[model samples]
Target: MAEVPIVVHPAIEQGGRAVVVRNEVAGLAHCDREVVEFLRRVGLPLSDDILDDPVWVEWRGGRAHDYEAA
Candidate 1:
């Protein structure tokens, strides 16, 4: 399987929705409105291909350190 390069940041809950920060492909950051537009542009299957990568497991578990701080 090809490794998908992505970074999944901790999800932020705003109002009643959960917003996740993600950096994908060419280091482009996506959150909030950008995420919606990304879904519209790339669609779910490609999005799922990126999201299902094992590299994100550490980030989801909070084991990955904050990238901004480093």
Candidate 2:
């Protein structure tokens, strides 16, 4: 007799949501409009908890990092 294999997927329901997942590709922001549009799409103004994430820390510029710490 032959056995069949089963495949499992984690959190399949959460797909297609606006979340900052690591290692996913990010496009270059060509202009200020693109930046604002991305933020708007992600449902900003984000809460402090969201802002405190390490991914955000890594992506922010030096000046913005200073403001984040303050």
Best by lDDT: 1
Candidate 1 per-residue lDDT, tens place, 3-63, comes to 4334445533321122233434322223334434444554444444444456532244233
Q: Per-residue lDDT tens digits of candidate 2, residues 2-33?
A: 32111111212322212232333223343334
Instruction: Give per-model CA RMSD.
Output: 8.2, 15.7
Poorly placed runs, candidate 1 (over 4 Å): 1-4, 15-48, 55-58, 61-70
State every prediction's TM-score relative to the real structure. Answer: 0.27, 0.29
In model 2, which range of ten residues has the least summed lDDT? 3-12
TM-score of 2: 0.29
